[model samples]
Target: MTTNQPGHTFQVDLRGLVDLLSHHLYSSPRVYLRELMQNAVDAITARRALDPEAPARITIRTGVGGGITVQDSGVGLTEADVHTFLATIGRSSKRTADGDLDLAEARADFIGQFGIGLLACFVVADEILVVSRSAKTPGAPAVEWRGRSDGTYAIRTLPAGTVTEPGTTVTLTPRADGSQWLEPGTVLQLARHFGSLLRYEVAVVDRHGEATRVNDTPPVWERAYRSPLARREALAAYGKATFDFTPLDTIDLDIPLVGLKGVAFVLPTPAHPTKRSGHRVHLKGMLLSDQATELLPDWAFFAACVVDTTGLRPTASREALYADETLAAVRDAIGERIRQWLTGLAASDLALLRRFLDVHHLAVKALARYDDELLALLLPWLPFETTDGTVSLDEFCRSHPVVLVTQTVEEFRQVSSIAAAAGLGVINGGYVYDRELVHRLPQVRPGTTVTDLDPETVTAHLDSVDPGTELAAAPFLARARAVADRLGADVALRSFQPVGVPAMLVDNREARHDRRRAELSAGADDLWAGILNSLSSSAPRAQLILNHLNPLIRRLAELAGTADPQLTETAVEALYGQALLLSRRPLRPSDHALLNRSFLGLLDFATQAAGAPAADNGTKDPR
Candidate 1:
């Protein structure tokens, strides 16, 4: 049989709750100081609502025995008020009994939303004592409420004149493990970190009875934007103080619709694209977090930003801002501000633009991928390596309307000298984003055609041999081709400028890979050799171009008719090896063996011409 059970309320394990708050809810035990200061600020704000002339001051004192006292001259609590607000967890007294006050409006004036601000102190302390006399309850005796972390609490009426003025004083007797936080220096540091920009004055009292104001009245960012000159100077000073480096430029950001105002500082040093930019963020004039990365777009890594917003809400721990639609809008607004600053610099200040490009061109290039306007302005200023030297894109285009680009630095290096000698300008597209940018140039700027110049295409622009020269070198070319066939290359006689070069090695991507794979499989066993041979069967063959204008090549062409076959073959191998070395291609074991044999044959020929005795067993004779 089923019976209906009576409904019952769940009782909270107070110790367990305190442990959770201490270990998990709050980010750190040091945040207890921030929680206390927030409560004090909220109390002061409430007091101002009642009497605008009330002193808005918070004082923190570190006691010698083992406790800390935070006193605020704000709206305090009466005996009944303490029982209702302090005794009950999560019950905030920032509202009235009528429940007419809206939570959002209260958030505008008050910092403490959850009444658990006091319970946050339980992370470091075991007992909390509060003595307060409300400003509304004038002439009423002060009340004292004491509470322990173990779910026990008491309240009683204090003697009259206990508090000469309306205010609240909270004293925390720390647990044995948390005694380090009771030091005056630690207390002062924590107070300044969270309350440095608070509107009200905050003071830390040392044991000598001297109080030092720990916060500035108005933050530097808030005061600096009054004038352009002042903003520049203030940003310079702030950048040095915060990042320990001078900023390149300052970008002023103001999105009143989102209640955001701050400056984005352009970093002087180059920032890697993958690095996370740490931005200091504040909520309602109080420091929230120093590492708020999500507040800016990912591409804005080149800037370090500091912002204060009344529009964005912090998570429960207050260590980071909530990621929501409002935050997304704010992030875009901040990014747009930075984008405007960059484009403005590009339009008006060429000298400054050059300086920025010198240090941060990579960052600008990253942005230019998506921003056409920026790309348009930055294109002429960006530099690229050309056959002549490093020159701006505008200069390169002025000389050669049809741009020819090599895809890598090595490829450019291999042909740059020869191309320059031939009066052709080839751009080095090896740097970051250069190749992609070159490819996009046609779409961005009309009437511009960018051609990728590989080894094969480059040869077409070289000088070609006349019919007479080709007929004279035909026999030599046939012999050279027969020798090069063993190396998987074809040989041709071509006349080119820079007649001192004997030969040039030209190959397309497929040909280069084929040659490399053929070299790798030369000594492999049957299985591996067959696999590589199959893969390389479709590889394009390389061309070995002989410079017919060079005297050595012309002599070799004549020697092909009467010289010994071994001597002519050695000369051909030597030319091929020299060309390979000039192209910077790695040599295989077979190529090295051929090179050794050719060198030894040439040495023996020289020895015979000198009328010296032949070395025995191919060893050099000691004369």
Candidate 2:
């Protein structure tokens, strides 16, 4: 017997809606001021469309008990407009009487962040009083609308001459807890904070009847400078005030197509790759968000920026840009502007380029990982640690036509000095991006070859000892070889410079990794051991290279067949242990055992030689 109605009015509870806006939609209650300013801007923009000479001004007055009145000489609402846009919570510019709201049309005419116009006021106020006269319609009666936070609103046609001009006046009676937000000090601060760069004139009137103008200063990028240094100093001051740190440098940014202008501050210190703070963005001169991250490309995280745009529109919350085709292009264009600054520095200013790279090289390196053109432009300027001391990649590459690089820090340390003594050029590529960048150099510069260095490669460059010397030290070499077999290593005698190093351990990364897996497999459960053993590789065994040119090896050779044969065993353990220490690789169980046994054996030998009682070999208190 009953027919269900498919369409019905949405029952909006104003109290709950206000709370939702304060807690979720808006970042803070202070943004209520921004919402008001945006509405004023929207109205003024609409009025200017009909009448270009329309007064572009907004005035705010504070009264007793934290009440605020905001008046704007903008297109005001008629009776019907008031009912639809103000009294009816869900109604807005989009809705027409007969058809659905023209979404594009509504958005185009009122582009200044229609953040539930006039409804946001209820967040800080218990009751809102609005009196407006239509600017678009002549001989229209002024309308008065009173809306409260209890979901009640009333509308009435006021007397003909109550509002003399075509504009809107909104008065808010602050709630008990919102008094501080509406105070004179807070009003002034917030008005200037949100409206300082607004194109329209905004004024705040005090209790004593004096009005202070807010929006007196233009944005930093628009300011006139006496000279380049003067401009730099001004921008530097602005950077310090806004970001709380002195920037290393600044890049001026402009996108004339979108009527956007800003400055990017290169941070004085490194920035984390993720979790970056957002840029400050202003729409039509009002601050939309101080945290508009999507406004720039992801690579722009190293720079802090403040931009003002009239060409882009904000989303519903009015906090960030609505992502669309235009926004994507704008971000690309802004990234290009920053890119040009670096190229410009490369072309003209070497000293400045060096300074900037010292702080932001990592950011550039990250970008260069993708862009080949940027890599080519900045390759020479990049720094590298070479055997000839730290130098430019250009200098290192030019001197050593075939560049040699090490993949890890310890490997570079093992061979850097010896390679230098043997007239070999080696570059330390242990740092992040170093190896990849070195590998990529040939792609940019034609004729440069990058070689990967390992212990075996360095060993190939050392001079070989004569066979007769090896024969003379055959017995001692046998002892060394026996000790090396326990650690799955072999022994070699080579004559190289830096003879102070008695022995050196040389192993490539793959061999070291495979050795570690074998060690782990030895100690694992049966199932785990099988799984780990399956992962092992047939890599080259590690080598303990003894320096035949060193005096220590010569003395050991003299005691080849001594009566005390354990002397050779103890000496070989100590030498192998020292070589392991120099390599700086993480020690395995076998390595640890060898180090302990060698240390105790050497201590016992030294004590007996000194004719003193040998120290206890067990874990006992010496005292």
Candidate 3:
């Protein structure tokens, strides 16, 4: 009982193995077609090594009752070969009995390695039947190998004439779950999707006996690069077929050292910078993946690629390319190709460059961040919003050597109208990547300087009032200063060009923070208010600039001697509240209360001047 048998072997749980192959090893049941096609292609290659004149073709036929037959003209199997290769899992037929065949040195150019490729059929089928004849054994008996998904198989020698040719035919009877794939249209579509670029001829024979070839024989990418005209036509067709959009431009790529060749399509519309670049990768003319994103650089989202490479290896599922040294080199080469296209466009075609920038400016901006060549050429063509209108950086720099830029859309909106009225050009750098590019302008162009147009800068641009006018408005200015202090802002009288605007509230970053904190803590207890005040010690002060050129301010200055001092103070508070509202600043409760009281006081003053009895609480008095 304790003695061990020498020939004992571990049994494979076929059900578990099938489940792993179907769900884990392969990405989808659809890949079963690809694996079957790959095995057929390798078998054809083996037959070519034995007989150079043999036809290498794979023909697929779909039956009415959920059955599929794939027949290939290749080196098939004898009775013993069927038991050794077809029966045994993970046993490759490419090797000889003596030793493992040097696959690299073999003339068959085998595309299959793991014996699991044949087993892939079981993922969609309940049973698989194989009828094959050996090319080496002429006039010998053919063999049939029947394998079931339930871990059982049968091998038997067929009649001498059962298979009249040296080839193999694999038939699959689909399970209930996979019956949808038995349709001729579905089979044909999957064939085209997986084997459209395969070297050998592949045809799908439908239930009506009509045979349609699915593969492109030599593949379009291989032939298109032979001529310039062909390349353009092929890329246009490929783009429309693959992505449903015609490409704006096509870039042909070739890197012989790493065995990479492809075409990159420049998308017509703006692509989000975060989206993954879709690249269709093929290995030895067989489709690998339609969404091979790792083949391109991250910033290359504006382009889609269809590439073929013999050097790169696919993963176990054969669904995607492995990221190896070869792939990294190819990625860099493809990036360089895109870079050359942009630089060439900039050098040769201004009209086209402008057109490209109109749609794909964000992509260009991303590239410019790291690429100096693109930055140098693209900077002049890039457009930015200005006081006049949209203008190119080149035009802006020429007209206004010292560029005035606002960092935010809110800030730009507040100042743009005034800047336009003053005949000053202010660049809106609020958009994505605009501020960073503008800030970097000085590094490239030594004389160009970008100044942030904050509230302080706007005040600096305002004209100072003459000394005589300042003296005449001193009494009104003092009253306004008192009102501004109560509102936590400084008061100034500046002569701005907009005579219609009586007042303007200007604030820098720190000043805005201080004002916000003051408003927020106005309702807090004394301890919290004290803490906030201490924290805001370093914060800047906000300024309320009264327009001396406006008639309202001139009248207020004239009333300095005649108007009651309290009336002057009330008028100053109302003007400051109006300034806050005009600047889009959130008014505090106290400011609202002040404005309400000022309205009532002005109403009472008007009633007194008209010599009419003031209605108490809006009730009309009967006299």
Candidate 4:
């Protein structure tokens, strides 16, 4: 058993352990430099704690031989301290005496930890040498520890010229493959990415003696909210910085849900990050999440807020988050905050809110259908039909003669068109218009159907139709019917006499009969489906309800019984198809062709009657 040689000492190389930590634990090799620098910074922080007036800066130096030095005037370590801190891996001050730290349940504080940071050095170095003296024991001899990961380490008293100051100076000799770490650009990039937010200033020194600080630690998001600027200013700023900010979506909550604080920023449309949506969530002045879309429902994705909550479960990597009681409370709080803020925006900034809806109206309308609780807050920003252009739902209800809210966007369009045609200005209730909601709201005027009409077409129709006391009915009905036939559907003639046009399309489904049928089969009812199927089976027909008393209808009926009945029919058909086309209905090609042919023949007949002699071949008018 006497295998040991006399006067011999065993020495171990520590590179293997360092390699495991530096290469295995961290994502990359460059992180080793960051970790060492971070440790130097921490040392200085400790020194400052002991001596508050200590200089708050970290210095770096590099040598062409691939030797890197990190120095700090912070807390240093004695021989015993170094042995404990470096010798025992995975040990940090963040842990309790029992070595139990509830990282998941802890409040959000980014200490930049995980004990393996020191081992990161092996990523670029074959050997590490440190010289340090604890600020608490400035007179104590500084310590030196040297080793590779092979087996054991060598702890010895500092050599004569090893250290002259009370701080840390860690020198790393680069491995052949790791020489690239000494490059100035590589070093600067690492500082910017990981240590940008360090409280103390950090500077990188290059081989040529040049130095650079790559970070501006305090970004604007760290600032508190200021008084909101004018709409134009806010809008312009929002457009310029939308990429760096969260989207501002509004919500209405009856009460606060969690302890979250934030400033509202109305962001620009088409933000860079789709999830740049929602509030920029934070904790302890540090960003927790950018979108925070998960905390709120999909409808709330439009808000750009800075939601700062103290409660969160931030993982060690600082890249992911998890929900706990604290996070839940925060989520609920944010929801309520958004709701309240939206309500305020409606009251104080109604016009701006309306402008937002003009583009995001679809999202709002969808919410209106599903989120009645928020309807009160959203209604003000909704768009309604107006003579000047579309107005806000609030403005529409206030200025227009009639205000109506529907369950779906399509339904709202239909009702508004009817009202507009009757010269009874109308507004869209909110964002949504559900066909099923016809029962909840008052029926649009009897005999006046709210037919679907695109805004552009509506404008054109109003421009072309002469404004009169009563509309002409018979000829208009015949024309409307012909178009409806081409579209493979029937257009019901409105009994109401609107001043703007000779004929107005009516929403048959909005009538009492339609409502009754809808109610009878509320659960997965096939009645409407059946109606569509039936309509599809037959040749398109339009219900030509005769406004017998209207001047236009009377004239057309009188003309029907005369020798020129064919010409009268042709005229009615042309007008009807034109109206249907404006309503966005599809016309059957054959029916359209028939109407076209009839109109051409009538044109020829009219030519003969106008004293423009007929063809000499004696081809009678095709009619």
Q: Model 1: which ten-residue window has the lowest total lDDT?
A: 614-623
**In lDDT terms, which candidate is top?**
2
Q: lDDT of candidate 4 vs native?
A: 0.53
Worst 10 residues of 2 by lDDT: 94-103
Residue lDDT tens for model 1, 203-287: 9998788998988867676774667887788888888887788898888889998678888888888888888688988777678
lDDT of candidate 3 over 116-207, digit per residue (tens): 88888888889999999888677868898899999899988997686788888999999878777767788999999988878899999988
Q: Against the hidden reference, what TM-scores do the models get?
A: 0.81, 0.86, 0.82, 0.58
Go through the candidates in order and give each one's C-alpha lDDT: 0.81, 0.82, 0.81, 0.53
Candidate 3 runs further than 4 Å off: 1-8, 94-102, 106-110, 136-140, 224-234, 406-411, 420-425, 430-432, 442-446, 451-453, 467-491, 497-505, 512-537, 542-623
Predicted structure with the largest TM-score when compared to the true one:
2
Q: What is the lDDT of residue 214 in candidate 4?
A: 51
TM-score, model 2 to reference: 0.86
Poorly placed runs, candidate 1 (over 4 Å): 1-7, 11-27, 92-104, 224-227, 407-414, 430-432, 442-446, 465-507, 511-537, 542-623
> What's the residue-level lDDT of 149 in candidate 3?
90
Of the pair 1 and 2, which is ahead by TM-score? 2
